[model samples]
Target: MEGEHSHKPADIKARLAAGPKASYLRDWVYGGIDGTVTTFAVVAGAIGAEFSTQVLLVLGAANLFADGFSMAAANYTATRAEREDYRRLLEQERRHIRFFPDGERQEIRQIFQNKGFQGEELETLVSLITERKDVWIDTMLAEEYGRSNTQSDPVRSAGATFAAFGLCGALPLAPFVLSIPEAPSAATGLTALVFFAIGSVRSRFSTRSWLRCGLETFAIGLTAAGVAFLAGDLLTRLF
Candidate 1:
């Protein structure tokens, strides 16, 4: 049974016009998980080294801003590189279409023919696709180069990463900042919660169950903290 008016011509036309939206889910999740893990790792290390609350706060704060900004900048550069590459490829395709329409049309024909179109049907499909320059270029980008139509804004992607990193990273430093007793334990607990929360939120974009995602992220975070703690403890003993 059809639900609502989803199958209506008007609805289909509107949806197609809107096209696919660029997603920043990966940026947010990447920044959030790394922030929690790295901050907690710092906390664990400081605690193992028998550092004072003031020292822990100083270290955690430094890591939060420095690392977050670094990650954001790197993401921005990478996204800009992708956009540049797409533009270069787009221009290249446009030139090829302009200078060599026959070869381009043949490429289109071969592409669809490989997909099981045959004879008059394949010719019809090629004709339909090649009639419009925009559609023709889009088809070539998607089928030949595996490019996505939606282009994500580098600024937005970087902003999302930095925001998530700062927000989640702050959790592990909160207790020490506020001068709470048992600050290390508080930091650990808060960081653990953030890890699980980030993972659960990420599951909205994936097929995985929230529980599995949460537990997976929680384990990875704790493991990183554990390693840092061990290293700090060893160094303190050795020195």
Candidate 2:
């Protein structure tokens, strides 16, 4: 039982047992990291360019709304595209099974045979699965095509992505918007925290250490900000 591999903590165990649904947090991490990075990039760039707080506010706010919505729209379209691809493949499988029953059966048998099943067991499995239309199509879809039932909900995914983007993206602009002193520094700190939080939250769906994940995300975001800031500074000096 110790090495059985299914064992997990009580709270997270149920979710993990459920498969890819738990992995939907990918959208959350994706949106959060980008939102913070882009917004902070603007803030850092404005500062490095010796731009006024007003300019920082304007740029950051503009990025937060425009870029956030764009990313969400892209996510929605991409998710829908994936679903459509799956449907297309499933339909193809259906037609294949209908038109060429023997060939389809052979395909199933060959698949299982390659997996080490043969003779009685192989025939039994092939017969059992192919006996039902849905089972047969699903088996081909999964085994042959590597598809799964855990299709992402486009609406939910887009909502999660945009919500995370909006919240995390607001960090860099918060200081300037709120008239905080040392606005640039405040924005940097806030964005860093957001980055760490996004990484930490991502760990919930992965086996990675919370601290390590948090630091990795922080490093990526800060590095991007640093580059943007340096570019702005270089451009400012040149022009």
Q: Give me the overall lDDT of model 2.
A: 0.85
Return the TM-score for each candidate structure.
0.90, 0.87
Candidate 1 ranges beyond 4 A from true positions: 1-11, 231-239
lDDT score for residue 87 of model 1? 97
Top of the candidates by TM-score: 1
User: Which residue pairs in candidate 2 have backbone atoms (N, alpha carbon, C) closer than 3 angstroms, thus clashing?
Assistant: none
lDDT of 2 at 225: 70
